[model samples]
Target: MRSDVQQQIISIIAREAVLEPEDVQPSMTLDELGLDSLGLVEMIFAIEEAFDISVPFNANEPAQSEFDISSVGAIIGAVERLICGQRPEIVA
Candidate 1:
């Protein structure tokens, strides 16, 4: 059973990808969805708005950022952790 947050996140990403939510899988990477830098940024913004949580993601150097957006599952886990009061480890 997927949580509401997970479903919403899938919806947001799927909307951006112009695909169906079912097409978005947890193991899939953002790159696999053909999400460019702008798309990734937009997804991040949508997620922040949906969860009302601050994501420490820097678009320019995402790999070094505290927030993880490498894969759909990663984003889901990160959001869940964040909403549950687990702060992202500040990389910088």
Candidate 2:
């Protein structure tokens, strides 16, 4: 069962990807969803706004950023951590 947080994150990603929220999956990568650099940046902005938290993401160097963007589940986990006032584990 998807938590409220998970569902909200999926909705944000789906909007950016021009997909239905149900079509977005935790295991899916943003690339797989056809999100380019611009789309990715927009998605991040939406996430931050919706959650009322700052996301540590750098579109140019996503892999080097503190927030993980490797997969949908990673993003949700990171946001969840942020909402709980915890720092995200640095993605390696």
Candidate 3:
């Protein structure tokens, strides 16, 4: 189940991606959401402002950062971990 935080993030992403909230799903990748690099960066900024959390995201190289942007679910999980004040473990 998606947490309230996750839902908020989804809402932000949906708004930024210019898609309906119902179209945003955990399984969908940013590419699938039609987010270009600029859109992704904007979404990150919106999320940071919305959550009042510093997202350690590097849009240029997401795979190399502590932040994960592989999919909606990954983003939600990373945000949840950050909200819990824990660093996300690097998944192999």
* Tens-digit lDDT track of model 2 for 13-46: 9999999999998999988999999999999999
Give the runs in model 1 whose Cα sits over 4 Å from its true position.
86-92
Question: Clashing residue pairs in candidate 1, if any?
Answer: none
Give the TM-score of each candidate. 0.88, 0.90, 0.87
Top-down TM-score ranking = 2, 1, 3
Could you tell me how far off, in angstroms, the CA of residue 38 lies in candidate 1 after the best superposition? 0.4
Give candidate 2 misplaced runs (Cα > 4 Å). Answer: 86-92
TM-score, predicted candidate 1 vs. hidden true structure: 0.88
Error (Å) of candidate 3 at residue 16 is 1.0
- Which candidate achieves the best TM-score against the true structure? 2
lDDT, candidate 2, at 14: 97
For candidate 3, the per-residue lDDT at 17 reads 92
Misplaced by over 4 Å in model 3 are 86-92
Assess candidate 3 and give its lDDT. Answer: 0.85
